[model samples]
Target: MYRQLHNLLLAAVLEGQLPAGTKLPASRLLARELGIARNTVIEVYENLRAQGCVEGRHGSGTYIADLSVDHIIEVPRPVEAMPARPTISHIAPALSQRGQSLIAGAGFSRRQWGAFMPGVPDVREFPARVWTRLQNRHWRKAAPERLSYAPEGGLPALRQALAEYLRSARSVRCEPEQIIITTGIHQSIDLTTRLLADPGDSVWLENPCYWGLRSTLQSLGMVLQPLPVDAEGLDWLAAGTRPAPRFVIATPSHQYPLGMVMSLARRQALLEYCRLNGSWIIEDDYDSEFRYGTRPIASLQGLDTNELVIYIGSFSKTLFPGLRLGYLVAPPQLAGAFSKGSAELYREGQLQQQAVLADFITDGHLTAHIRRMRGLYSRRRQCLLEAVQAEFGEQFEVIGNNAGLHLVVRLPDRVDDVAVAEAALRHGVLVRPLSRYYHQSVAGQRGLLLGYACVTEAEITPAFAVLAGVLRKFVKATSA
Candidate 1:
């Protein structure tokens, strides 16, 4: 009853039926009028007063508070009673050409976690308790300095921790001072593109590269040269005839989607080519941790004698994507500039998180987590492979399965991978079409990128069965 009375008065006040500064009826009078107890009227008035809807003087009755006229006057009417809205006259502002292109080409899914979602790690396997404990430790005595905006290159301790880890784990050569922390590879790449290259300058990218990176470069107005990826990864010979690029972005440790590790000869040639041509190499060493049955490959940055490579890595895969922690190993000569640019351009801060991460790395939690995930992912990868083999026999070819979270299944030329992917999604499976990754239509392949990392071993067979059914229908249709 009190709720009903409170709502009634609130509506009246908001609708301006009881205008601001107008005195409400006395409690006894309002109760008698509504045929309710005086106590209920008192409660309603008290609630209104608490909500700033009304005010009471020491000896006077309650009156409506002075709310803005605009708020009170703009109450929405029922659909049938509302008048027609005015037609828009002037043209609304639109996105820029580059912005439009980005929107058109955006490939990231809103749903990142599900069966066969590529490039996503099993975040469920992450050590949440340990991470929470570390976070708590930092916050327990979070000094004013710790809570404030991070120092120029990020939290000093985090940078040092990253430098040490990279040196030992990935064979990336760099001192602590040369490390610049970033939110993730996107920011790291953005910093490289802005600081090193100019608009209209040529930038060489892997033919079927990560879409997000390609979009990032395009948005910055760089002329992207999509070099083909053979078994060796990024055919440098094919790119010899083209004009020298200002920056060459390569995944030397493990090429994305295709998952091929850049050959040693190719890596060396790439480094030497960049050194001779005065070009910079942005070696994105993303997902180099989970190799199966082979010794882990070292980074291209470590082989640099001429300081031409800018190594980028992220903990997003190893720890979790939400952490958004990554680092760039810059040449000692350019560290200060990178640091200054990072501060001036992005002003990224998350000092307390960085501090916690520093402790997480130094205390051996990060390494231990990676080691455990490697074994788990390896089993899941095998499960997926067996499921695929059981369903398809030898109808398809699997590429780049020795390393990384995903493997590519090359299909016959006549097959439409995009159509198969769409059908699969309708039937509750997620797989990226290989053709969509290519910048040019001429160089596209008909294949599917199946990610087994996030999918559990138990869920793998069923998911693949659904995907296989979709594939079989497509194959039969194409053959007919």
Candidate 2:
């Protein structure tokens, strides 16, 4: 009876009748449900114990092993029919699935597999209590102006705070009037893209650049001119004067997708070129605060005496995502135009959130948070690097290690990054494939861009163990 009972239990688990973490009925209850003798159930329990099928904790009943959870078994039931698959032809342009290929953060999930999605801050460490207290205080002392339509330039206090903070931290040369608060840097991108470049106007984009930005330009019908990036950053060789683009977008402090810092010579050349060509340079200073090496790179806006650069920064990377607060420091001449555009179309940013963030920066909370997260992310990067080397050995090479939350893994030409990404997802690990960033598919350079900022050191070992298995399977399949 014990042998028969053990077989039945195993069969139920494998058939998806018993889901992972679902507590088993007590011995008495199980005996009654299956019409078995109490002794039979007890003997079966002992047999399962020996096989490690289930574990019982004090005060907690026996639970199904996580590894034992099988695929969901379809059972016939009278219910509404599921919707059919969406057609590409019917999708609206504004809401189309075109740019969804760009890997942003892993979409929200129920499983706690511990995603290493890029541009994500560890929300567990956010100073929520302090923020809430500040919010409550601001609300209680609110002026009528607080709820009313704000000045298009944004809350004056916040602008002043950001002005001082940028000067000290980013070496930015700007006045309070030059700043305009937007939702985030992405918003700033859209706004600047619309403001600077007309439809069909060419814009220089970093090759293997941030897909999100490229998609935004495409949505606006802006023509993208790919500029190849190497160790020194964007190559200006083929970026000749003909078909001259109206705008040039770059992540100067740390290039996106691949974290290459622009050299001083290149930076000066960029500024000079943009100045002479009358091109508007959009400098996205994303993730500049988390530099592991020397002091953070001085922003291109810091050196912009000719006012060719529009500097953008966001709190989404520094603080939690919910903040949704960011600012753009435009050249003095364009201030009136941007401010008016903000007034007519997108009047008034989030007043309360900006006010709180302004105080946070003013009171030094923002600085402290950056300082703490820098250390935390640095440790996570180190652990991830060691784990990757330990797992893959000479089979892999990592790039973009100096400045961002993530690094790109360059695999052998035989491996396809998209295939590797799919296998990893099946094993409950999430990662971005580097091929996703390429605008036009080019041969060679296929691999994963793994981010470790949001994951814990304890989670790395087990996560990588699963990742290693997936890679091994991928290589095996390709070779076979």
Candidate 3:
């Protein structure tokens, strides 16, 4: 009752219905009229006073406080009395052409947890109990510094743990001092772009890369040069013919969507090319923890003898996306600048969470969780493969399934993948059209990117059945 009255009066004051300096009705009178206790009215007034919406006088009633006229006038109007909103020209100039393009080309999905939503991990499998325990432990300790803003680079313990783990697991050559913890791969990319490259500087991106990365780079005014990717990974021969880019962003461990590992020779050539051309290589080694077959591929950062690589990784894939914990390993020469830039631009702070994550890693929970998820993901991958083969026979070809959580199924040349994907969504299945990943539309080899990591064995076949129905209809229609 108090809450309702408080909200009503607050809204009235804010909307100018009860204008500033207007006296509210006496508490006793209001209570009697509304059939509530007088104390309730008093409480409402007290709350409004606390919020600065009203001011109280010792012997007088409460009065509305003076607020900005703009806010006060922001109330609903009758349809007949409503005024047309000011046009862009009357207010301010329209967004720049680059801003307009970025908004138009935005590709983030509204749904990220349903069937075949690529690049998402099975967050349900995350060790919630263990994480909670670690979090609680930190809270109980309640160190003032831990609760405050974190240092620019990261929590020292977390950085040290990450440095040791990366050295052994991903073969990354970096000290803890070289690591700068970021929110995720996106922030890492943003920081690197701002610090290393200027506006209008050219950056090489894989022809069909992660849409989010493309959007991020484009939004920052970086001139993106799209280089084609074959089975061996990014085509350097074609890249050689193009003007030298200031930065090159690649996923060497597992390329996004396509899931191709950059070949060893190609990795060396890329490093040498960057060395000679004075280009910085931003290696996004996201999700290198989950590999189905063979050993995990060593990171491209380890092969850099010239300190040309800026390695970025995230816990989003391995742990959970909501964690928002990632790290950037800059070269020794650039570490201090990267750290300072992170602080200056982002001012990122989540020290307590960092402490919990540090403990989670040091206590070996991270390694154990990864090991468990790898086995489960392997089974789920097999289920998806079987379902696809059962539904389509040998007509559809699966590519880049040897590692990573997702794979691409190449569709027939005539089939429209976008149409099939839209139809699949209607039938309660989600898959990304391969063509959407490309910067420019290319003919031949249209496909669907299907992620099985978050889907269970039972959900796999049923989901694929829906997708298969959609694909068959599209294929038949297009062929006819």
Candidate 4:
């Protein structure tokens, strides 16, 4: 009440509605009239008087201050009163072009956690108590060095822990010295792109790839050549004769959105291609470790004898998205440069959290957690698949490897997947239109990417019921 009155009276004074020397009503009288407590009115007057917007005589009621009060109280201006364009708009900025494109693009959904939200793990299943204990232990012994900026990319202990985990789990041939901790895939991409390539350099990306990867490459002004993926996944030889790209970004462990594993033959061909062309391969091993039937495929980096692959891994899928802790395995020669470059570029530090993560991993909590989540997510995935099958019956074809957080349900060519996604959103079920991931339109591949990882098994069927209603509305002839 006091704040409301203060703002109202202050604005009245600043706009000159209440002229100088205009005596205000008594606190008791104004309070009664406004149906507020007398204290509320008194606090407003005291605050205004302190700011010199009002003055109170010993015996007289408060009055709006003299016109000189204008010198102190700034008048609020309407948003439209400002200039038509920002000052930076006066210059030709390449960043502005990218910024505008990003604004126009499909980004991480506004509602981050919910049914069928892609790329987010079930954070509730994380061993929070264990992490909290580790975090508390770090704070109890609070080392100043640990709290300071991570001068060598990240905490050494965390890097070492990650190195061991990746080596055994993903078959990544990396030493502790080769690991440079990063904020996540985006930062890893940014750091590598900055270090390795100049503007206007060519970057080959998988069509219908992770949207973040596409956005990052586009922002860097790299000429993106999107190669369509098939069952074998992003085959470089299929691209035929063309100028060798400076970088090739591949998600060989499990192709994103579509979820196809790159064949060993294709993986070998890609590595050989990059090695021959002196290009770099950014192998985004985002979430292949959660395979249902068999062990996750070995990383593409494990085969890179020529130091061509930059293996990027993230805790976002395995742990929780909020952790934002990821690591890049740089080639041995560039490891030191990446560490130094990271410090100068980002000045990133959350060393205490990194220390906690290190303790968690080394204590075997991370491994236990991953093992538990694999089972939980696998069950949840089955629940969603069953619901999708029950609702759509074989009318909608669900593609992608039987792995990862999400599944792509292919729509009929004539139906609009975007409309289905939008309508599902209106009914409070989140989905990503598969077409959004493609650089070029493929009407036949129109589908919705449904994430099943974060959603509870019980909620999956109910959510899909709602989504199925939306889909049937958009996908005519399947309306029943």
Evaluated with TM-score, which candidate comes out highest?
A: 3
TM-score, candidate 3, is 0.87
Q: Each candidate's lDDT (Cα)?
A: 0.90, 0.81, 0.89, 0.87
lDDT by residue (tens digit), candidate 2, 201-265: 98987887787788778777787888888887877656765665788888988888888988999
Q: In model 2, which runs have C-alpha deviations exceeding 4 angstroms?
A: 1-113, 441-444
lDDT, residue 312, model 3? 98
In candidate 4 the C-alpha lDDT for residue 64 amounts to 85
What is the C-alpha local distance difference test score of candidate 1? 0.90
Give the Cα RMSD of candidate 1.
6.6
- Which order, best to worst by lDDT? 1, 3, 4, 2
Where does the lowest 10-residue lDDT sum fall in candidate 4? 86-95
Q: What are the clashing pairs of model 2? A: none
Model 3 whole-model lDDT (C-alpha atoms):
0.89
Instruction: Please state the error at residue 381 of candidate 3 in Å.
Output: 1.8
* Candidate 4 off by > 4 Å: 1-95, 440-444, 477-480
lDDT of 4 by residue, 94-206 (tens): 34778877657746678998999988899988888888888899999988988788868799898899899999999999999999999998899999999999889998888
Checking candidate 3 for backbone clashes, the offending pairs are none
RMSD of each: 6.6, 15.4, 5.0, 6.1
